[model samples]
Every structure is written in C-alpha cells, then in structure tokens.
Target: MLRIWKWYERCLSIHPVKTQVVSSGVLWGIGDVGAQCITYSTARKRLQCKDAEQECKIDWKRAAVTSLFGFGFVGPVGHYWYEGLDRFIKLKFQLRPKTVKFVAAKVAMDGILFSPFDLFLFFSYMGLSTGKSVPQVKEDVKRDFLPALILEGGIWPIVQIVNFRYIPVRYQLLYVNIFCLLDSAFLSWIEQQNDAPWKRRLGGGQGRW
Candidate 1:
C-alpha cells in the first residue's frame, strides 16, 4: 500500500499538467465502472463459464462512453478551472480584501463556473450512453443536476482552497485523485439511481461493465 501511494505520488510529481489531469480523469472513469462491476455485475457471481471468454465480455460501450466523457470533458476543464480559481483568489486577496469576503467571493465564483459544467458533462454522458430521448434526458438532467452540483461543488471548494494554498503543483493530481475516488463512488450511486431498468440490465447492473 505504501509503495502504491509512493508510485502515485511520483506519477503526480513527474507528469506534465495536462498528462496528470487526463490520466486522473481516465482512471476516475475506469474506477466508476470498476466499482459498478464489483458491486452489481455478473463478475460478482462466480459463475462457471467457458474458457474465461465470457468473463472478459463485459459491456465495453458504457465504459467507453464513460471514459470518453471523463477524459475529454472532465480533465481539461478541471485543469483550467482549478488554475482559474487559484488565480482569482490570489488576485482578490491582493486587492485590499477582507479574508471572509475573499473566501466567500472565491467560493461563489467557483460554484457558478464549475457547477453547470459538471452537471452538463455528467448529464450529457448519461444521455448519450442511455439513448434516452432528448426531452427525457434533459428533464432527468435538470432534476438530478442541482443535487449533483450541490454535492460536488460544495465539497470541492473546501478541498481546492486547501490544495491551492498549500499543496505544490506537482502534487495536485495525486491530491485530486484521492478526492476523485470518493467522488467516483458517489457518482456510481447516482448513476444507479438514474438509470432505467433496461439500461441497468444492459449494463449488467448499474452499467458496471
């Protein structure tokens, strides 16, 4: 465990910023699917199968969509947003600001920018993967999105504030990944709640594969 943590630390320290964000996003997406697979998929059954081929045939389509969403949407955006927030707070503090006021402004700005994007990405990914009609998907997106926004946006700023303040740039990815693991678990639960029965069946339970 210590060795694995050390390797993670090294990866965060050595990789380029873009590489760190993209890799973390991709791994986060995979972790989501992995959690689902372990929690609800046929992999949990210990079934007797022919030559292990069946075991390998988990649902790639869902995983692909999830990964694409994570890598393409979440990674780059998160990187930029984190940078932006850091700069914004620093600027605010430098401009004759009280600590409470600066912190409040920073948190508000972050929520306004980050919440909508987060909702859009998650909802878009779900809509694409589930093949839900546009109206239906949009409605579902609207319904669940705010809760997700509150959940993620609320927690992330506190962490981000600490991260930006103290943690070095080289350690950002590792720091974020630890949070991502928790976020991924919550996201998996949300996905399970929002998915249709048929979609769940197709995904082999909560789209695990």
Candidate 2:
C-alpha cells in the first residue's frame, strides 16, 4: 500500500492532471460496477430470481459512460477547483490554511456551490448520454436531484471538514476520488431507483422548483 501510494505520488507530481483524470475515471468505473452489482442484487431479490446460476451481469458501457464523467468533468474540474479554491480562500478571506475559519469556509462553499453543480451535471449527463430528451432529462434531474442533495448533505460536509483540515490542496481531489468510489455507487444506486416509493414521497411534496 505504501509503495503504491508512493508510486502514485510520484506520478501525481510528474503529471498531475493526467493522473487525476485517469485515476478518477478508473475509480468511478469501478464504482459503477459496484452500483450495477447492487442494483442487480436488489432486482434479483425483488423478482425472486430463483435460478442458482443467476448472476449479476456487469454493464461495461454504463461503467464507461460513468467513467467519462469523472474523466471529462470531475478530474480536470476538481483539480483546478481545489487549487483555485484554496488560493481564493487564502486571498479573499485572509484565513490561514488549516485554521478553523479557513476549513469552515471551504466546507461551506464546497457544499453550497460545487456539490450541487456536480450532482446537476452528473444527472444531466447521464440522462443525455442514455438518449433521454431535454424535458425527460429535466424531469430526471428534478426527481433525483433534491433527494441526492439532501442525503449527501448529511455526509459530505463532514468529509470536507476533515479534508480541508488535513489533506493538502493538490491531493484533496485524490482523497475525494477515494470516497467517490462509494459516492459514485450511491449516486448510481439513486439514479437506478427510478420512481422508487421513497423518491416519490421525497419529490412528491415539493412542486417543481
């Protein structure tokens, strides 16, 4: 593990953007595989797939599409975002790095700004890539976005607090990508749960925003 991390560090130093992109892509792809497995299990149990030989079939295309999101958006954007965010906070607020104020501001801004944008993009991209029309995509986003944001809201701020306090700016995205392994799965699971009862209840009460 130490050796692998050292090797990763070396690669990161030599080629930051490329490394972030590739790693994010690979991890998100793997996360999608996990999501597929989870979705399959849920379906199998719900439908009572009694065949002993029944197995979860991985969707490589979906995984690739999910990976493209990480590669094309998260990696490059996250890299610059953290870098610029750190600089901006330092300059704009004059809060010293690792200070409580500094970390709190980062967490607040990240949750308020970037998290929503990221989720919006992910849902929109997924819908379009899968051939949904603009209106359909908008509906998908509406159905999925609020629930996702609310659930993630409970978790990510805590994660970012630790990240801003401990992780270096350059390595923060890597740390996030690590957690994104699970996050991607969760998001995929949420997306796969189309019109689920809980989703209807959550989205039902709120009229179109």
Candidate 3:
C-alpha cells in the first residue's frame, strides 16, 4: 500500500490531471465490482441460491462503462472544479485556507452546487451509457436523484470539512477520489435497485426491479 501510494504520488507530480483521471477510473471500476458483489449477495439471499451458484459472476463490461464515467467526466471535471472553487473562494471572498469561514463557505458551495450536479450526471450518464432512452433516463433521474443527493449530502460535507481544513488543493481531489470508491459502489447499488420499495416510497410511485 505504501509503495503504491508513493508511486501514485510520483505519477501525480509528473502528470496531475492524467493521474487523477486514471486513478478515478480504476477506483470507480473496482467500486463497481464491489457493487456487483453486493447486489449479487442481496439477490442470493432473496432467492436462496443453490450452493453451486454461490460465487458472484462479475460483469466486466458494466464495470468498464462505470469506469468511463470516472475517466471521461468525474476525473477531469472534478480536477478543475476543485481547483477553480478553491481559487474562487480565496480570491473572491479573501478567506484563508483552513479558516472556519473558508471551510464553511466551501462546504456550503460544494453541497449546494457540485453535489447535485454530480448526482445528476451520474444517473444520467449511467442510464444513457447503458442504452436507456432520454425519457427513461429522465425518469431514472427523477426516481433516484433526490434520495441519493439527500443521503449523500449528510455525509460529504463532513468529509469535505476535514479535506478543506487539512489537505492542500492539489491533494484534495485525491482525497475525494478515495472516498469515491465507496460512493461509486453506492451509486451503482442504487442504480441496480431499480424500483425498490424504499425507492418507491421516496419517489412516490409503484414499481419493481
């Protein structure tokens, strides 16, 4: 782990944007694998799968698609977004990094702006990438977006607090990408849930996976 991180740091020094993009893609892909396992486990329990079917079969194609979101969108966009946001807050508001006001402003702006955009993009991208129609993707977003945003909203602000308070601008996105491993799995799980009962409760419709 230490050696890998050292190598990553070296790569980051040489090509920061490229490194973040590749790392985000790889981590999101791994997270999708985790999501598949979790989804399969839930199905196995619900269906009482036989011993022969105990092991989960990973869908590599699906994983690749999910990784592309990280590579094409999250990595590049997040890199600039964080860099720009930090600069804007510093220059616009004249808040020092790690100050209470600075952290609060960042948290507020991030939650209000970036969080919703990220969730919206994830659902829309995943839906369209998997061949869903525009209307279908819109419906998927309507069903899943709010629940995800509301749930994630509670947690990420706290995480960003620590991140903005301590980590440097260059390292902040790396810190975020680490947490995105779990976040990607969560978003994948939510996508796979389809019209689960809880989702129905939140989304105000009757549907099933």
Candidate 4:
C-alpha cells in the first residue's frame, strides 16, 4: 500500500492537470467498459458455454467514444466544479461547517445538472444503437436515473470531501480514478440487472450464469 501510494504521488508530480484529468477520465471509461464486459462475458461463458468468445467481445468502439466523451466532458467539468466548491467552502482553511455541506452541494449539482446531461447522452447513444423509441429510452433513463443518483451522488460527496480537503490538486485525479473503479463495478451490477431480460432471451435461462 505504501509503495502504491508513493507511485501515485510520483505520477501526480509528473503529470499536467489536463493530462491527469484526461487520463483518469479515459481510465474511468475503460473501467466501465471492462466491468461490463467482464460481467457479461463471465455470465455468457458459465451459462451458455457456446460461442462464448463471440459473446465476450468488448465494444472497443463504444468504449473509446465514451472515454473521449468522459475525458472531454466529465473530467474537466468535475475537476473545476470540485475546485470551485472547495474554494467556496474554504475547505482547506476551515473545518467548522464540516464536510457534509460541501458534499451536499456537490451531490445536488451532480444530480440536477451533470446527471441529466449524462443520461441524455447515454440514452441517445442507446436509442441510436438499439433503434429503441425515444419514449422507451426516456423511460429507461428515468428508471436508471434514480439508481445512478443513489450510487453516484450518495458516494461522491464523501469521496469529494476527502479528496478536496486532503488530497493535493495534482493528485485529485488519482482519487477520482479509485472512486470510479468502484463505481464501475456498481454500475456493472446495475446494468446486469437491467439486461436480465435480454440475457434470458439470448440464453433461454433464468440465472445469470
């Protein structure tokens, strides 16, 4: 753990701010793809045991596009929002207000602003790819949004508070990467739950495996 922390610190020292955020965002996106692929592939292999290789194919194009989007959109935006919030709360300078307020504000902004836009982008992509109707996709987005808020907003504030208060600006992406990895895992489970019907039709089975 100490060695890993040292390497993380070194990376922070060497990378530019934009580079760090971009790298972290790309990695986070990759993590999402990886988590989904892993879950899907594992289920396919265990349940079907046929054409598993084909089933396991990761959507590199989708991942790449989404990664670029994340790097361009979420990374810079989240970084700045965090910076501004930190300054607003004087997080580094004070402890009286506690971290809860800052966390609440961050979560609120994320739910109100960032999440809606993200859901739009994601649903748009899904609609285009699946030829699903706009209203159907919109319903899907509505179904997922609350869970996303619970997962993202609920977790991010605590993480951000620790990140803004303690971690240096240079290393903020490192904190985000760690959080995003865990988040990717959670989203993978959520996606699996959502995909159960598709999987059943494809596999003619009930269990995931």
Candidate 5:
C-alpha cells in the first residue's frame, strides 16, 4: 500500500495535471460502471425478464466517454479552479485558513459560481456526446439545469463547508474527486433518463436524455 502511494506521488510530482486527469478518468469510469450496474438491475426488474440467464450488456462506450470527459475537463479544470480560488481568496480577503469568514467565502464562491457552471458542463457535454443537435442540447440545459441546481443547493453547500474548513487547499480537488466518483455514478444514472427509479419517485419529470 505504501509502495503504491510512493508510485502515485512520483507520478503526481512528474506531471500533476496528467496524473489528476488520469485519476479522474479512471475514477469516473468506475463511477459509470457502478451506474451501469444499477441500470442493469433496474432494467431487469422493470422488464421482468423471464429468462434468468439473460443479462443486460454493459455500455462500455458510456463509461469510456465519461472517462474522456473527466480526463479532458473535470480534473484539469478542477485543479486549476481550486488553485486559483485559493490564491484569489488569499490575495483578496487575507483571511487565515479555516477561519469562519474564510470558509464562508470559499463556500459562497463555489456555490455561486462553480455549481451552476459544473451542471452546465455535464449536461451540455453529455448532450453533444450523445449526438444531440445544438438546439436540443440547449433545450436539455434548460429543462435539467434548474432541478440539478436545486439538488446541488441542498447537497453541496454543506459539503463545501467541510471541504474548505478542513481539507488543505492542495488536496481539495483530490478530495472532491473521491466524492465525485460516487456523484458521477448518480449523474450517469440520472442522465440516462430511461425510467430511472428516482424519476419515477419524483413523479416522472420530463427529461430528454
């Protein structure tokens, strides 16, 4: 275990961006795999497959695309964003680390700026990746953005509070990536929009996946 850590640290030192991108890609791929597992179960139950031997095939391409997104966008962008935020706050506010105002400021900026943008990126990218027309992608952004943002509001503020106050700035994005692995799974499943249990539970909201 320690040897693995040493190897990772070596890679991270050599090329931080590349290492992070790869980590995000693999982690996000795993997330998509998890989502696929749930999706398969849901499909079998929903379809009431009579043949016990028949199994749903995993969509490896979906996981691949998810990894691609994480590699190209999420990890690289998150790294830069967190570093820039740390610098900006240090320069602008001059608050000491872990202070109340410092934590609040960090959380506020994340909530106000990054949350909405992150949702936009996820839906728009997924839409384009799945071959939706430009207009269609834009339409998807509108239909899903509000609900996603509402949920993010309920979820991320508290998360950011802990992240900002406790985790060091250097490792913040890494910390987020760990959480985001699971988050990506949920996002993947919800993005599928094919009679997902949550959708049915939420009264069957209309969404074009």
Candidate 6:
C-alpha cells in the first residue's frame, strides 16, 4: 500500500491528468464489480428459491464502459470544475473565502451542472455501449435522467459541502473520485431498476443474444 501510494504520488507529480484518469477508471471498474456482486447475489438467491437453472455472469462490456466514462468524463470534469470553482471563489471574493455562502454556492453549482450532465452521459454511454439506437438512447436518457438527478441532488449536496469546505483545490477531484466509487455502484443499481428504460430495452432485445 505504501509503495502504491508512492507510485501514485509520483504519477501525480509528473502527470496529474493521466494519473487521475487511470485512477478513475480503476475505481469505477471496482464500483461496477461491487454493483455486480450485490446484483448477482440477489439473482442467486432468487434462482435458488425457484430451483431455476441459470448462470449469473458479469457484464464486462458494461463495466468497461463505466470505467471509460469515468476516465473520459468524471476525472477531467471534476478536476477542472473544482479548480475553477476554487479559483473563482477566491478571486470573486478577494478574501479568504471559506464561508458558508461560498460552500453553498459551490454545492449548488455542482448540483446544477454536474448532476444532470453526468446522469445524461452515463445513460447515453450505457445505451450506446449496449447497442441501442440514437433515438433509443435519447428515450432512455429522458426516462432515467430526472430520477437520477433527483437522487444525485439528495446525495451530492452534503458530499460536495464536505468536499468544497475541507478538501484543498488540488485534491478536490481526488476526493470526488474516491466518493464516486460508491456513487457509481449506486448508479449501477439504479440502471438495473425494473422500470429503467435501458433495462427494459435490454430485455426486449435479449432474443438477439
């Protein structure tokens, strides 16, 4: 663990963006694994109760796409966004600005911009990765985006309050990445909901597989 952190520190010193992206990908993959474990366990119990014959499998492609989105979107967005937020707060106030108003503004901005956008990206990426059409992806986005955003709002405000108030600017994205591991798991569960459009579409198209 010490050696790993040392190496990560080295990477951060040399190549912060790449390090963050790789870290985000690995963590997101772990999140998907966590999600899969919970889901497979539930499925396993149901199968046992029904005495049904089936194989529970991991969807590697979905996991890969989750990682891809984290690497491509989350790392970059959070890094730049948090940095900008920090700089803007200090510059806009021209004072040491760790006040309640500043933190609240940061949280609000994050909720406004990040929550809905990230949900849309997740749904769209998942849809396309699973071979859905553009229209299908749009429909899925329309169906899932609002509920996910609402959930995101409920969760991320407190999370970001802590993030903005305590974490340093350089490490804010790191803090977010750590938190997103569980957030990704929650999102994975949400995607599997009975009424989730992507799930329904997958069910409809299972005949092809």
Q: Candidates 1 and 2: which is better by lDDT?
A: 2
Of 3 and 6, which scores higher on TM-score? Answer: 3
Report the candidate with higher lDDT, 4 versus 5: 5
For candidate 3, lDDT tens digit of each residue in 28-57?
A: 999999999999988988887586367788
Better of 4 and 6 by lDDT: 6
What residue runs in model 3 are displaced by over 4 Å at the alpha carbon? 49-54, 204-209
Order candidates by TM-score, high to low: 2, 3, 5, 6, 1, 4
- What TM-score does prediction 2 earn? 0.95
lDDT assessment of candidate 1: 0.62
Model 4, position 208: C-alpha lDDT score: 25
Q: What residue runs in model 6 are displaced by over 4 Å at the alpha carbon? A: 46-55, 93-95, 194-209
* lDDT tens digits by residue: candidate 6, 26-79: 889889878877777776776676533355577887888888888898887767
TM-score of each: 0.65, 0.95, 0.93, 0.63, 0.87, 0.84
Model 2 pairs whose backbones collide: none
- Report the C-alpha lDDT of model 2 over 1-209, residue by residue, as the tens digit: 99999999999999999999999999999999999998888888788757623877788999999999999999999999999999999999999999999999999999999999999999999999999999888888998998999889999999999999999888999999999999999999999898888987666225775
Query: Model 4, which residues run further than 4 Å from truth?
Result: 1-17, 45-55, 91-133, 188-209
**TM-score result, candidate 1:** 0.65
Evaluated at residue 85, the lDDT of candidate 6 is 77
Q: How many clashing residue pairs, candidate 1?
A: 0
- Candidate 3, residue 6: Cα displacement in angstroms equals 2.7
After superposition, candidate 2 runs with Cα above 4 Å error: 50-53, 204-206
Clashes of 5: 0
Minimal lDDT window, size 10, model 1: 200-209
lDDT of 1 by residue, 96-156 (tens): 3335655566557766876677667787677757788877766666555555665676688
